[model samples]
Target chain A: MENIDFSLVDWSRAQFALTAMYHWLFVPLTLGLSFIIAFMETLYVKTGNSEWKRITKFWMTLFGINFAIGVATGIILEFEFGTNWSNYSWFVGDIFGAPLAIEGIMAFFLESTFIAVMFFGWNKVSKKFHLVSTWLVAIGSNLSALWILVANGWMQNPTGMRFNPDTARNEMVNFWQVLFNPVSINKFLHTISSGYVLASIFVIGVSAWYLLKNREHQLAKKSMIVASVFGLLTTAFVVLTGDGSARNMAKYQPMKFAAMENLYVGQQNAPLVAIGILKEDSKETLHKKQDFRFQIEIPNMLSYMAFLDPNAYVPGIKDIVHGNPEHNILSFQQRSEKGKIAIRALSDYRNAKKAGNDSLAKVSQATFEANYANFGYGYYAGRDVHELIPNIPMTFYSFRIMVGMGVHFGALFLVILLLTLKNKIDKKRFILYTALWTIPLAYIAAELGWIVAEMGRQPWVIQDILPTIAAVSQLKSTSVQITFWMFFILFTGLLIAEIRIMTTSIKIGPTEDLKDSVKN
Target chain B: MKEILFNIFQFYYQGFKSMTLGKKLWTIFIIKLVFIFLVLRIFFFPNVLKSNFKTDDQRSNHVIEQLTK
Candidate 1:
């Protein structure tokens, strides 16, 4: 703790967060829009309608711009794992790198190889072949997402890995367990579904813009029909998987769950806060309980949500920090002590091995294994209990915003779909305007989902295994700071370029002649 | 088999030759990728574990020292 550079840790985290958030802006759009474009292309092939072809090409153009930029930022994020978090890489690279390598070798190449035919093979390839290529592009993008999310989910709930004492690294024990981990499944489904919802909003919003301007009415209306239906279907999955994610969080990461609900005290039949405004409480008071300026809650809902039983006891931040004997929850202090013991035993084992005392080494190894579950807590042995708690307000508000916006987008999708079906959507100016404005809100909700996830899991890079402080590379804070600003500028420039290209393409409208289309 | 391979190669060759905006976009993509993988990676980012240690034993030893100390 004394040797640890807090500044380096903070800067490294900031850089990663910056890169991840920026990369996400382009990725979700690529994930969902590719599917939407494929569906449109499928419609064209089935019906032999040129209008559908134009519409497919229109959305495909936007997808291409987004996919290109997304790959740029994504490459940086992968490299950062090695450059910024080398220790974490060394510790879990065996398990972590497998999924990532599979993604690069299989999913990425699948996407890249097919994407050319999907884009440039418009007139060159057979219609069926082109359509299949389009579908492959969509599936490849999502498969890429699946592998990445599996790696991320493993970090949240580190299963299927065993720490080797001699190697000082976690090695993969069961690949299937890591892939099918409950946390990974829910996270993958929820994240991709959210992307589907966002892409739907993007299409509807862009189409609504055309409607507002009274241009490309047929194209706009047809796109709205497809996007709204797709959005509505995926939004349902988002909500379903979101509930699964919440349940998993409560089970696996109770502290994060508690912070999300702003719960400071343990209780049975706990209520779920629907909306709340928190007050900045003094340190002493905060340790006891967090003050809420105003809140609306549903009785027994939190208990039911967490454990599927309204009467089940849910421990809060206080209950976790200070042991809850009634519910059999160990306090942070107890865990920290166990963690310290594990650390000491590991060191002793290493020393004994060096001295050729095999008997002593074996005894130390047994001790280390017993307390290894709480090994990450060893870093916080002498720290305040407050250090164990994640930021309450950030997690709580991010959860509410993400959820509230999701509901809003779901309703918007349903309304837009129904109206489009009735042939009354274009006439409804307010609804059209709302659909148009909802694009940014959709992005905000998506970003907030990641914020709640990453921020709520504070301190730990790998849950129960590695705290972030120890995971960071031993580097100067200035180096990380310099790269952070460089990435900020580069990503921002790419985003602006993407926006300009997309807007120009949109304004050009869907036309037969590429040259005339740009001129128009 | 030779004709099939030639046809496949021709399919992509003709598609690439016919690209309008696609070529420009591909150029931008290539430039961005080169900047990221070559420039940024070479100058700013390095695989610290690989760079600092010659073997797994040394890397693990260093990490163990960090963990215990």
Candidate 2:
């Protein structure tokens, strides 16, 4: 702990988080809008309605603006993996690099290739070919997301890989297991569904703006209908996948699950905190207990959600840290000891091999294999046990924000859809205003979902396998800080440019030529 | 195959030539890519494992050292 440069770790984490959050802003819109545009284009081709084509082209333009900027932040994020977390790269690169490489080589190229056709092939290609290209772009972008989320899911749960004693790194054993890991599937579905919801909100919000201004009423109404229907269906899927993700979190990363609920004591029939305002606890009471100033909880809901059994025992922070014999949970201190033993065995194996002592090396190897599951805990052998606990307040609040906003968006979509169907949308300025204002909140909820996922799994870059302190590159803290600010300024600039260009395009409205063509 | 390839090439060429706002966006995209790959990556983001160690064995040894020491 004394030798570890905490400053470098903190700065690297900050820089990566900044870049990722910014990149996320554009990705969801691209994911969901591509499909929406394709659906509109499909309608245009079927009915030969120029009005549908105008709407398709209008949304496609915004998608292009977003897609370009997304690429910029995404490239920087990939580079940061090499620059800031080189140790992590080498340690698990064999397993981790596979999914990322597939994402880049397959999904990314697929998206990039067809995106041009979707954009510029409006007149150059046949209508059917162009429509196919649009759908392909949507599939390609989501495919890219699938591979990336698979990699992230692997990090959260870390399956289908084994540590190699000879290489001192984890390597892929079963590619299929890694790809189809339950965590990966849940994560992929949940993440993309949430993106779909965000994109739906974006379309509805923009269309609502036109309605509020009394411009392009037909186009706005049509778009709102398509978007609201798509949004409602995907929001249902988000809820289902969110439930699956929570179950996975409970089973695989109990510490993160505990922090999310701010549970301090182990219990059966643990209540789920629906909403809460947390009171600040002193450092002494931090892991022991958390005081919620106000909270609404559902009886036995947390237990049922986590394990499908309302009476099932759920271990909390204290139970995890102190070890619960009744629940058969090992304490962090105990795990750390096993980790140290594993670490010692590895060192001994290396020394024995160097000295050409085969028997000693074999014995040490066996010891390492036995205690390998707790290997990461070895890094905290003498450190504070409290470090095992993640940030309770941040995780708890972010989860609430994400889930609460998600429900609000669901209701908002339904209300807007009903109002639009009844032809009462124009009269209800309040609902229109709410739909318009929800654009930023949609983004906030999406970002908070990631905050809960990433931040809640704190201290571990790869859960249980490797702690973050050991995963960072041996670089000067100042270097990371410099790049952090550099990224902040550059990404901020690009975001402003995107917003300006998108708003200008929206204000221009659909071209008058399309309206004239429809009249003809 | 040759004619098909030519048609594909021609399609993209014509698309690129016909500029509205896309050309400006592409220019921004290309410029950002250049700056990122050529300048930032080359200057600040060297692959530590590849640069510091001459071989996989050496790299793995360095990681082991970091882990245990």
Candidate 3:
């Protein structure tokens, strides 16, 4: 620890932030756009509508472009995790490697193989076969998301795994336990719904643009109705899933929950702060450092969300780190060793109460808790345990932005549905001006929501277990800078090329321009 | 054993006749590259790095040495 510089930490973080932001620009579209294309194709099959087929083909071209860029950006991430955080991967490879390998061997290969056929075999393949291909692509994209979330869930909940000092790596003790972790289900649902929101908004947006131009009125109307239905379902599900995601965090990652709530002291009842600058306010009458002014608390909301009991106590960050008997137990330097003691104590209590010698079972459970406690201790020792977590204010604001947009879109969808009901969708005002502008905002909200969930767990790459500082590559700062530059250049070039292909495809307008006799 | 040998030869003869000369060379080049990649992975790498690294905390350091090398 002596004479080692912390500046590389800053450099690596900045580089990662940039690369991740750039990469994310393409990924959501790949996740969301494929679903929209599949919906269009399914509609065509259902209604025997030629326009629906055309819409499916048009969006399929855009999806192809986005998919290619997403893959290009993503492949580098797999290598960078190793190249950048050489030590971290070696340390957690036993657990980390499993999800990643599954993602590659199972999901990536399935998606890529079918994608080529879907993109190029439109005329060559039967209609039913093509539709199946579209569905496969959607399944493949989501399956990839599922595996990545499993890896992340292990970090958040630290389940089904333990670090062996002899091996110097955390190994998976139970495969099923790792897959069906308490946090994974909620996080997976939340992430996938956000992807749906992104896809629906994009479909609605481009269709509205055509409506505004009065270019493809009939096609645009169909696209809007289908997109609106998807949008409504996804938006509602995102909100419900967000609540579940928060509750999961509260149970397993109390520090993250407390940080997100910005609750520093233990309290019987807590209020949710809406928005404001967080500052230390010293008052003449009171000695307490008031964290915020003009803050509003919704009574018992957090308790209801976290525990399903309105009066249940939610531990604050201060309580978790510095207060009371359990807090002190966690704060000790030899905390993992202390964990062994607690496990033994619990075992004795259970044995005495049950009147049986289940010593073997007790020993295993003790070992599990002891190893987990050690990992937690490792995280705290590396980072500023208090400030180094889910950036509370950012998460709080992003969560609201995402929720606000969801509500706003729900209202917008209702208004559109009303206009459609009145047989006024063909009317100029409803079709041209109102719906067109609101389309872009949906994707924005989706992006912000994801930023909140992922960025919220900062400082630690793996929640409660590994600090990002410990999880990243230990290469010289200059090496990271060079690779970062190389990636940025390559990614930007691919992004531009993808945009050009999409633009040309849309401009050329669905291969009909090459028709008449060029038809197969 | 004789039948297996005969079948292997037949497979190689069919493959040779099916492809152009340039394609065959490219395929051979890729195969050789893969062979080198596997060799570097197995005996040459982790073993060579393990030899170079000597310290109390040798395990993690050994991984880095192998990966970087």
lDDT of 3 by residue, A56-166 (tens): 777776786666545645554555565565556666766888988898887758886677557655665688888898899998988888888888777777778866543
- List DockQ for all candidates: 0.73, 0.75, 0.08
Among these predicted structures, which one has the highest lDDT?
A: 1
Per-residue lDDT for B3-53 in model 1, tens only?
Answer: 999988887898778767677778878889889989899999988888889
Q: Kindly report the docking quality category of candidate 3.
A: incorrect
Q: Tell me the tens digit of each residue's lDDT in model 1 across A141-256.
A: 99999999999999999999888989999999999999999999899999999999999999999999999999988889999999999999999999899989989999999999
- Give per-residue CA lDDT, model 2, range A147-170, as digits (tens): 889989999988898888778778
* Candidate achieving the largest TM-score: 2
Q: TM-score for candidate 3, please give it.
A: 0.78
Q: What would the C-alpha RMSD of candidate 2 be, to one decimal place?
A: 1.5
Instruction: Give stretches of model 3 more than 4 Å off.
Output: A2-4, A274-290, A326-372, A376-390, A421-423, A426-440, A496-520, B1-58, B61-69
Prediction RMSDs, each to the true structure: 2.3, 1.5, 8.8
Comparing 2 and 3 by lDDT, which wins?
A: 2
Better of 1 and 3 by lDDT: 1
Candidate 1 has what TM-score? 0.97
State the lDDT at A512 in candidate 1: 62
In candidate 1, the residue pairs with backbone N, CA or C atoms under 3 Å apart (3 or more residues apart, or in different chains) clash, namely: none
